[model samples]
Target: MLDDITGKVMVLENHNGQQLEQQPQQQQALQTPKSGVRRSTRISRPLERYSPSLYYLLLTDSGEPECYEEAVQVETRKKWEQAMKEEMDSLAHNQTWDLVRFPAGKTTLQNKCVYRLKEEYGGRKRYKARLVVKGFAQKKG
Candidate 1:
């Protein structure tokens, strides 16, 4: 009954199966061309935009790699420029090095170094670069 479930089974009627052997050349005719397709590969890292200008965050942690491509919006860019200008102007106005040519005054007070930091202005998250003079190097000529 189980054999009859799918189809009728044919019994071997003769032992002539070995007599119907094919020539060795006939096997070669069944070969088909092989495909040249390659397996697909993907990268999981973040994409970077290459531009002439790039910025980075200088972190205090010595061994950390802080490389990233940050995008600044137009409004933020304007604000950053303004802030940078203001900071530079302020530094200039302070005459950080105006009174030079003194006799190399107080070596005791020469340990201080001046550094200008970029502070945000006009409600923008973007920042700009600024220049500062190191107070310790101020010479009294």
Candidate 2:
């Protein structure tokens, strides 16, 4: 069954795969008035919507490989290599970092390439690669 509340349709299914009807309170709210004009539970006002960058925090992709080795094991090694090369080229073009000699008693941060498949709704998939510094390795200043 489909319930329309606040102009949004919500479809709920029971454990037995049967659609569930709306609760009595929801039904009463949807009841029409005796007046000539019908009352609607549907919301006519515009809603406030926002897409935050932290949306990824709520999602976890089990299919995604965690590390470069795992990525190579799952996806085509050639594709990962091409993606890495592209990322490196972009970093170089942007001059993202510079090589420097490590000071004595100071630790140098390690870096790794993170690879993932990015896909848009009804759009083509893309292989993305990014180099991330191991920030935890940095010494407290």
Candidate 3:
């Protein structure tokens, strides 16, 4: 039996001349529409009609990796690795940091890799990677 209000399927069984109602194992509760609330059938303008490029942008997914480990695990591992390499090269060229031995009594700050997918004006996607230090861990000078 189909319930009109809840839209749930109810199973009715007769056992020993007694009728029993049994509900399905998996049941989902649906909200019942209020009275005098009719659904609209109006059609609005399509996104492609207004701007095809915007429609394409909306459909495209920016599959950017979250971390360094995830970046190497995805299908575009080479691209992500290249982006990381480029970022490291740029940092080295600009003398961003110096490699030094850790001090015995001081704690070292950790760093994280951030990835972004930038879309150019012509819809070309650019994979960018940035290495940032955790500044919140730093102490006052």
Where in model 3 is the C-alpha error above 4 Å?
A: 1-62
Tell me, by lDDT, which candidate is best.
Answer: 3
Ranked by lDDT, top first:
3, 2, 1
lDDT of 2 by residue, 45-97 (tens): 64434344344543334455568877677646777778889999999999998
Error at 103, model 3, angstroms: 1.7
The backbone clash count of each candidate, in order, is 5, 0, 0
Which residue pairs show backbone clashes in model 3? none
Deviation in Å, model 1, residue 24 alpha carbon: 69
Which 10 residues in a row give candidate 3 its minimum summed lDDT?
54-63
Off by over 4 Å in 2: 1-62
Residues 29-111, model 1: lDDT tens digits: 66687998886687555445432233332233222222211112332445445655776687788876565655663453433
lDDT of 2: 0.74
